[model samples]
Target: MAEAAALSRPAGVVGRRTWANGLFVLPFFLTFLALMVLPLGVGMWLSFQDYDMLGGYGGSVGFENFTRLWEDKIFLRSVLNTVYFVCLSTPAFVALGLFLAISLNDTYRRSAVLRSIFFGSSVLSVTIVTLIWRLVYMPERGLLAVSAGAVGLSSPSFMTTESLAMPGIAIVTVWWIIGLPMMLFLAALQQIPREVYEAAALDNASRWTTLTRITLPSIRRTIVLVAVIEVILQFQIFGQVHLITNGGPNNATRPIVMFIYEAGFRDWSLGYAAAASQVLFVLMLAASFFQIWIGRSKQED
Candidate 1:
């Protein structure tokens, strides 16, 4: 009887633990369904039909939205712009972040301050960052223009010219977001065992060799994570352009997300917006899968 009672007590403890876990998990799960899963399912369905703010799905239009996107001029331009932004900004952030991370990993007093200054930028409200840069990018009285004039060079409109506008936006975005990956890489760098570096140094590995061989190889997972995250976030860039450029200077700064916003709100073309979003969604999914595949292959190697 005592053995049976002991078995029952173990089962009761297991049941209590399961209940506690479920209780702790329920809020997050419910929030995810409400905010993410449900909306995604609805958006996928809406992409197949004509959905507007005024009404629900306005009957099935088959692939008309998808088909129309292929022929959309603005949408095409937005796609190009987004591709350019991602290509240009992703590398800058990843490289700069990694460099700063490696440089700061040794942990001096100045390094702490520098890390705070760099990572502090990431915590700023995007609106505040956009507004500040908007002032800085001002053609005539802006700091950049004033600096250029001081240097005896002709000051050009950074935000007004097609050639320079997107690059200008890219620079601001990089400054704003580069810190996140930088901090991540810094943490990953700290996790590396001091013994590994010591051993490498004993073998006469140069600083460059140590970094490339020991530091990088150890932080491979973190690198992949930061790269994938930056790709996803920067690919959907909208707030900066919306505040600073508004996809202006001949739509040179128009990202895919900005395109969706303009179509839905500015153009009042909800169906077209939904269609464009579907395309962006597909592109993001493909990129994510490709990253995962590459990561898996690298692991195998």
Candidate 2:
């Protein structure tokens, strides 16, 4: 009777454990299906059909939207503009973040304050950020113009100028995002053991040599991670350009996301918009893979 009781207890415990694990995982699986899988599947299906809200779904056109996208000049321009923004902003984000992290890694009282100041901007919503910068870039009356006037110089119209508009937006993006990478780098820096630095000091290593040999090599993985993340995020840039420029000054700052919005909601071309979104998704996936390949190669070397 005692042996039978012990066997029965084990079966009951296993049944309870299974149910507990399933309960914990069920919410995540449901959320993922609702949010990600369902939307993606719907979008892909819509892309092949002539989907119009007023007229309802037309018969499948078989890549007609994609072909049209190839010939659409404005859409092509938006893609180029997105690439340009990514190119302009990514390096600045990575370099400045790394610089700040290295400079502020000390335990000094002022370092903590400085770190907070740099990172505080990131916590603000994109709407708040754009509004603040809008006032800063306002012509003649904005803070930037007023400051320039005080110094006997004229302020450039940031949003109105075609040549400077995208780059100007890039600057704002870099400022907003630099904090994330900076904190990541700081964490990576802290993970480096103190004994390694002590050994370098004992060997009479110069500051530059120590940095080049010890510090950088130790954080190589973090650098690659930051670079890839920055690239992916910058490629989707829309909020700043949307709020500040509205793709103005002759659509000079229009990125792919804005184009997608225009096609879908404004123009009522859901099929075409879906196609454009797929293109952007493919581009991002390719870029991510390329970065991962480079990271793996470096690690192997």
Candidate 3:
């Protein structure tokens, strides 16, 4: 009877511990369900139905909204513009970030100050960044214009020209987002074993060879991560264009997210907007998978 009671006591303690662990994790699970899962499920449902704020939910239209999107010239244009922005901005962000990270890693004096200066812009709110750039890009009265005028040249309107609008936004995005990848690369660089570099030095390996073989391979994973993250972030770009250009210059700068926002709220086409969002989501997911596959293939090679 005494041995049986002792065994039962252990079981009770185990049960209590299991309960305590569940209790500790319960809030996070509940929050995730309420905030992420629930909204995503509802959004999926709304994409299939004819949902309008004023008209209320109507009969299911199946893929009618999606079909219309394919034929929508404006929507298609926005999609193309978004792709263009992602392509133009992502490479610049990743390359510049890696370059800066490598340079800073080699620097021994005031490295922290330089890192902070580069990363300080990223910590600012999106609204603040947009407003600050708005002033910087404003023609005649803006800093760029003022500097150009002092040199006996006029500054072209950065936000208004069709050719320059998207690139202008891309530049701002790169400046704003470069710090994250830089810091990520810096961390990855620090993790690399110094003995490998010492051996390379003993072998008299050229700088280019060392970079291509040693440094890059060591930080390949971090490079993939930064590239994937940049692609995802740039693909969904809207805030800067919305606040700065308002997708002007004949919608040349408009992106998919901005179009979806306009459709859902401004035009009151919730179902159509939801369909567009789902399409964007799918594109981003595909891009991410493709990048991961490419990275894995390179690693294997």
Local distance difference test, each candidate: 0.86, 0.91, 0.91
Cα lDDT of model 3 by residue, 59-119, tens digit:
8999999999999999999999999999998889779989999889966668888999999
> Could you tell me every candidate's TM-score relative to the true structure?
0.90, 0.91, 0.91
Number of colliding residue pairs in model 2 = 0
lDDT tens readout by residue for model 1, 73-176: 88899999998998888889889999999888775899999998999889999899998998899987998889989989878687899988888999999999
Pairs of colliding residues, candidate 1? none
lDDT of 2 by residue, 1-301 (tens): 9878767787779799889989999999999999999999988888898998667788899999999999989999999999998889888887899999999999998999999999999999999999989999999999999999999999988889998998889888887867899999999999999999999999999999999999988999998899899888988988999999999889899999999998898989898899999999899888888888888898788
The TM-score of predicted model 3 comes to 0.91
Screening candidate 2 with a backbone cut-off below 3 angstroms (N, C-alpha, C), the clashing residue pairs are: none
User: Worst 10-residue stretch by lDDT in candidate 1?
Assistant: 49-58
Compare the candidates by TM-score and give the number of the best one.
Answer: 3
| Candidate 3 local distance difference test against the native | 0.91
Count steric clashes of candidate 3. 0
